[model samples]
Target: MRVNKLTIAALAVVAGLSLTACQNDDTAGTGRSDSSSSSKGSHSGGSAQDTAKDSAGNDSGEGQDTAAGTGSAKNGATGKCRTDELEVTAQDGTIGGDEDNTVAVTFTNGGGRDCSIAGFAGVDLKTNAGTVSAERSGEPAPATVLKDGESVSFSVSYPANDTGGSGVRVTGLVVTPPNETKSVTLDWPGAASLPVTDGSGTPVRVGPIGSAGQGS
Candidate 1:
């Protein structure tokens, strides 16, 4: 009976050891699974955060660009005077054979804002025929003031010897308004010897500025 009891006790001990081994293995597997799940979740969260940051940065950059463009356009339109719509027309007027023949030029100010036409010397006039001419009357010594929707007419004097006839070929004209620079091209008859009708409807009545025989 004692041998039988000892054998049963050893068997119980072995069974308990086996159950403990199985429990330890199960615990290790559960720990590994939990660790893997935690790692995956952490990596996914990090990637999501990075994507959100990138999206936010891109949106901010676009907003800044749009704002800058708007501001630049507004300032350019309001704070500056350009050659936008400013024009000069030359008409053949009778100068009566003076050494310097006077030509009628109509100056039109076509801007949204008022600007000073100061700096007469600042304004430059060039003829396509290589004649160097200067502004004659209404020249504001240094500049003149021209308001929007206003027009001024003045005479630009040129030497009769400098130009063959009233057919003046305008090349370039620049007016330096206060805080603004304006320039335009004169492609029409700058000097004329005959009354020619302008198809452009500027009514430039071209005629002999000095000698009417010169052809343009």
Candidate 2:
């Protein structure tokens, strides 16, 4: 009976130790699972943050590119003067015989914004006989900026015919501003006329566009 009691006690002790060991192993496994989950969550959060940062960087770059393209388009649209924005006029500069006959043609910016002009203007002398296109003078054409309500002028020169019989009857003048395609017509300065040619048979000439009051 004593041996049996001792054996029973030993078996109880062994079973308790085994149960405690199983509990410890389960708790350790649960702890390891929780740690792994936390590590995975941390890695996922880092990846999300990195993705957000990359997306923001890409968005910023695209924004800059879009702004640059818009600026370029705006400049291309508004940098040059349009034909409808200008008011053209012509005045006789020097119309006489035996001299260089010149007409002062002015262009006023009637638009609400500033614009630029460069190069020579296209000029045509309209006569009862036919239309005569003017040649460009040998002068440098500097780019000029005209503010709203500002003006620029150019000169149209032709050879004078001392013999009045050889002159053409000028009725009107067709003027086109620099870098423009549309044209404006103005009645020839009162009672003015142009000769078909001087003794040298020189063609009508148009000077470059210049500042106001400084006819080119």
Mind giving the per-residue lDDT tens digits that candidate 2 earns over 82-185? Answer: 88999888887773342576778888899898999889888887888788888888788898898999998888877655566747878789988877889999
Instruction: Provide TM-scores for the models.
Output: 0.44, 0.60
lDDT by residue for model 1 (85-178), tens: 4566656544565544445545567876665543232234555544343433332243345678775555444434343445545565443333
Model 2 clash tally?
Answer: 0
> What are the clashing pairs of model 2?
none
Cα lDDT computed for each candidate against the true fold: 0.52, 0.80
Best by TM-score: 2
